[model samples]
Target: MTFQAETPKDDSARQVGSILAVDCGSVFSRAILVERVEGTYRLVACGEALTQAATGEEVLAGVRRAIQRVAEVTGRALLSERGFPIVPERADGSGVDALVATLSAPPPLRVWLVGLVEEQSLASGMRACQAPYATVCDVLSLVDPAVLDDVGGLTARLQRLRPDVVFLVGGTEEGAEGPIRRGVEALSLAALALSEEARPVLLYGGNSRLRQTVEEIAGPAYRVLAVENVRPSAERERLVPAQNALEGLYLEKASHWDPSLDLLRSWSEHPLQTTARALGHTVRYLGLQAGMDVLAVDLGACTTTVAAQRGQAFTLRSLPGLGMGAWGSGGPKPSPERLALWLPEAIAPEEVLEVAATLGAHPCTMGQVGRELLVEQALARECIARALERAGLRPGLPWDLVVGCGGFLGHLPRPSQAALILLDALQPVGVTVLAVDATFLGPALGAVASVEPLAAAQVLEQDAFLKLGTAVCLEGRGREGDLALRVRVRYENGDTLGVEVRAGTLEVIPLALGERAELELRPGRGFNLGPAHRGRTTRVYADGGVLGVVVDARGRPLSLPAEPGARRQKVQEWHWALGA
Candidate 1:
């Protein structure tokens, strides 16, 4: 297997007919095979198995098992006698042309944040920490209550934490440097207290003027790296610089995360990539290719990532310990009452708590097909909502495409249930196209693009993405049961269906998969589709999937009844409407 750091300018230099990509997640490991069929890249087979890294075994055991399953399905010999992948296919076609991987199973990096102001640079630093798989163990800022102590006190605290990275950020470029310089001194002192081998790496992303002062204070004992200021000015924030630096650190530190990782690295021909960063790459690439604003939400067992791209601007926020796998973990479990708000069935709050506890204890178990499934979906909604809020994305932006990835969203019993979960959580305004990562290969493709851009692009366009259909979500408000939108659906086959959608209700129009239709939407006096289409008639040509065009006239910032009984009824009605 081989990997490249970036796509080469010349695409014709390397030729690969077959590719193998694997993702070693916390709870599950997956493998996929993509091959050229009729001169086009296509997904040939997929296999999944329980991750074996937690059992004191090398991750390769699980990856090999997944590959063995695929080989069984396609009658392809991918692994040799000793479990190592065969490189460069022979005459008999027993090997692949290339191999690549993405990993999310290793322990995240421990980061300590130091900045001048709590609400300014420190807050910006907090968001940047989400770029990599990292946890903020502590923070020291001018406004922090703990900052009242002397340098000695701060040194002792830092000694106890012993974080992997000390991220120092503050002040604007060419702005006040005194406060940030003081911050650097205090943290450098704390870092020097540790032994040479135990000392943490210091990264300064504060005012550029203090770069020399930071190096002088830390001396040679500490490894100091400087990057573009995270806060170039009070009103502007640039996270890519710090995010890139921390991501590099994550790659360096991850090699030691497990005894088997070193072996995995040795077998690889290229550098390992983080799952979150690779997923963000695919999101940005697809958005640019489609020439539209795009948003992607990946719900994993141990993490939930939200990435968005609008024109040339892109943002990614990865929140650890906020996924379905941590639903009832020790950190912060939502109250049953809060979760019950989204449950469609009349389930008691105590029952909800019990199920969440059991699921959290055994996050890898995946046979939920009853009330338990409903509870899990409810938990997914909350997790996605929290990740989006923390992502700091501008609300009410018309997302031309919204893609959902991960097991829970991908393996749902019905497509409408998947669509409904996204709708309830995102509540996106205006018209948007919804799709799912059909083969869980979005990140893998991102890794493969470095070596084979044609294969990655072809598979992504043909077989990797499954469109769940388009959504027409209303943004304005009107009295309940009042007319909100007059919709006319004109199918390509010359069939027409007209419906009057009322406020506070959900409606679905049936259009088969691969079907095409043109919709004419006329909003009522008080309601419109979006900010740009207020009180206007809009026409859109949309494609179909499992669920046709969804007309959500429930208003923006969808409201719910305060009374539990009334809310349950409304929620149940929505489920029935979607046939979920």
Candidate 2:
């Protein structure tokens, strides 16, 4: 619960060994070893292993193998003759240093979402769990007898799954308690079937019921904790505390099952909630060091998590059904109707679905056809929009940076395409910047941040973060072949430049850091940036980052012709504008 940096002790420092950080996700586990050399912490080596298996013992074995591999690479002999890694004598590991490990999986937590209604409150609870990296193994909402029977079935399913935790939530501020109460009773019955050692941890965040009575019913059999309701009122959400509690439970209880968990415990003087700690640390590092808001999406096979930090406040949302992996198959696939709305006129609805289905199914393939690329971008855009909306981010809010993390975006051969996917997907409305996680290391940085804030901050700025330059957009909606917009830039040095673009045009301008430009935009016919504004002028600031200035002309609802000729013409115009 308490994360503090290890301070170096003058005499005990010599006994310190090295620090190792590991992140184990659903698909992969990675380890990074940091050793003190010449009075500074230097990355010694990194290694990875597949976490294909699901059991706790399997995961632990994977962690051990990963650590041993990394140690071999570094030739550091991190493990003793008996194979146990050394623990740091000093908090800072002044001597040889110590080995600290953090594991990310075993799907340690399971939560049940309870709400007044299946669509609204239940949806909110599920979203909250998804955001903060918790899985909603089941959802219970008010329903008829048949629905109640379905809920019973779900409870049975959960008992079989044996989730380590349950998130009980329901009702807005002033709403009915009958459904939530009934759901709780069902959960209580389910808890009775779970093992005493494996008794589920329940988090109550529902309508004001008899707290004592509910606790009495569920607590003895399960570890029950209550927090503020997620939906206090119909329109308001109070999820931060409940989310915090979930993280606490994960770190305290669930982490013990991780295969490398004991090894991590031996290394870390304090407990660490691998995922939550990683996310929290990254947000803090980005906010404090960069002095800018950051949005990161980690899309996995089974779920997609979005973490955003603005100032001191942070929010994480999970979209369980939005991933491109096998687990996402049963959820809503991108509708061809929606894709038809964004595609150029030439692409047929069936064609769009073909592209979407390929990406939805294989998610790992790349170098899609130009038309397929467009459709994929459209799907990404929709997913981001829905994810952000669920996280309570209103459209038109100023977002300084958006970072994409996960296999689909991170491993892309062309970073530009990845950036384009995120830009189109999020449809960020204001002056924004973009980047990709390159390596899925946010969680690792987060874990380090919990212990050594400065180390985490340094790694984030110097090693972790990849800056995509400033993005300037004249927000608007338009159709294919429509003259979408034009932007003119006037530098402080008295240089002026102008560009005309159509819908779906992505343009990049090379600009160095510490540079500022005066930008004017003409929203053109059939497109409006903001409130019928025309030829608006604004200042654009460019930070010397990885990818420079990108001007996105992809309009909202990103209109494209449904007809072949018109769509091709529109695509041609967009390509011409970009000199493609």
Candidate 3:
């Protein structure tokens, strides 16, 4: 992905102008036009088309189709008379001021990790391999004698991998280097065994002292990059340098195959980023600057991306084969039975599994209804759960906010369906505001932010995010029919409504978008709204969304009846209550 500023049109760095940001996803290529109007940034037009990266068609074909759609929507002559995208604005003021792109179109970047210890540097290496486009093809350790036989076993394994990059992680700058050096020597030996063309790029992110030694061992034939140690120590990690290096390698491989990338390279000052990493960077900015911890999930057909922030630290993890689309043979595939649990009585587990496999083979947005909807929801829930678990984020009470992105969340007919799916999947507790990226602008904004921070920030604040009201999930335990929480909401108009919510049910109170209300909630003896407000009355103000303020009286660790009839009936009740 690339972002090109309008040079002839405007030279000022901070000046407000128009930008066309394109996001290339696994299944779709989307473009959103953000322009300065009346001194504020607003999304003027947006368009999408299926991504053709792996479909035997040129990737730029999909990019052009999506951009053309946006051009039509805005009634702007974004393309020149010669049919090329006009740069630096047009004489008639028809084209955009700048262009940027975020891509998730290419396959996962293959990486071979050579770390010292499984729990120390290997663990750090795993975190470094958390890039959206990264797939750890092989993790070789020097300690493993079975694989490192006296002959060529280790060399044979490395040759078979044919990885794009070899990530050497472990050891601190001031600490151990012997074990780390051995690992580097092993990599050197492996490189020597493989042909020059097949030799992987050596990225040494281990002990700082071993840099020159590693470079010498790899020789001039291997391309070596000495980045920051992923594990500065056993307890601390500095993983961004290695991750960035890996992303650069991914782009390097992509550019080699697609000449369109070379064109974009010349046009853009900032490097392209994976969709998930872009969103993760956006969330990181929000968390650090806005002072709010956030959890964001983007579900794709081929991979599931989870981005989250806790304090100043941010994490973005992508599980490639867990999505609803095709996956590589070497990666792990999600089980079909795991997706069948959320479905009703009519849809058998085996039936759901069959449909899942087919969708995995061939992904499409159409024909999604009835059993298909159930399967999608089930798959979404599983993906969300898996992402959160892998990222070590069990979003319970006190989460600042949670945002949902992707086709499933945005295209669902009812806003409540998306909200309910998030609720079921994340099971977030306490007072947490929910929102959705309706225009799929998070990744675009993220890419734009690298070039123009203000442009991306303004668009995100004014246009990209769609308010989905606030969810008040009463935490703790309660009897089935017992009152879990009682809410008294005072609207901006001075009108008040009170409701006593029983456990095991979801209640939706009507509140229009942009409407504000002050809420006073009191939970029952065992049930709690939050830690400090357990069994106590707590008051807070909130803004409304499409579905209004939803009170999920059903306690955290939400459960449904195991019996088929009861589960189906309960699910229907909740669905109807939420207007889904």
Q: What is the TM-score of each candidate against the true structure?
A: 0.91, 0.73, 0.92
lDDT of 1: 0.81
* Residue lDDT tens for model 2, 1-580: 1223344566454433356776656555677765545654555666766664444355655666677788677665555666565554344332224344454454435676655666666766765674355667766555654555454575577767677677777766577766666666776776676667766777787765545656877866677888877777777777677777876666565456543555556555655555545665676567656677778877654456778888777776655566654323665666776655445445777776676666656655544457666666566656766777877775555577877886666665466666656755666655677777765567776765555554554455446645656776546666644776677777768887777776667677765555666666666655555432333444445554445567767765445666757766765554443333
Candidate 3, residues 367-421: lDDT per residue as tens digits? 4467777776777787778778876778463666888988768887777878988
Give Cα-based local distance difference scores for all models: 0.81, 0.62, 0.77
Q: How far in Å is the alpha carbon of 148 misplaced in model 1?
A: 9.2
**Whose TM-score is higher: candidate 1's or candidate 2's?**
1
Q: What shift in Å separates residue 305 of candidate 2 from its native position after superposition? A: 1.2
Ranking by lDDT: 1, 3, 2
lDDT of 1 by residue, 1-580 (tens): 1123243567676578888887778777888888989867888999988778466877667877888888899898999998888877778989898888878877677898988778889989987887768889998775454563476787787778878888989888877876666666666676666678788889888888888888898766479989988998989998888988888887677666766666556655767788887788788888788788889899888888888888898888877788878877764586788788898768878888777787678777655478888888888888888888888874456898998988878888888888998899999888899888757777878877765777778877778678888889998788989999999999998999999999999998887778999999999867788875665899988888788889899888788888888999999999999988
What lDDT, from 0 to 1, does candidate 2 have? 0.62
Query: Using alpha carbons, what is the TM-score of model 2?
Result: 0.73
Q: Each candidate: how many clashes?
A: 0, 25, 1
Which candidate's TM-score is highest?
3
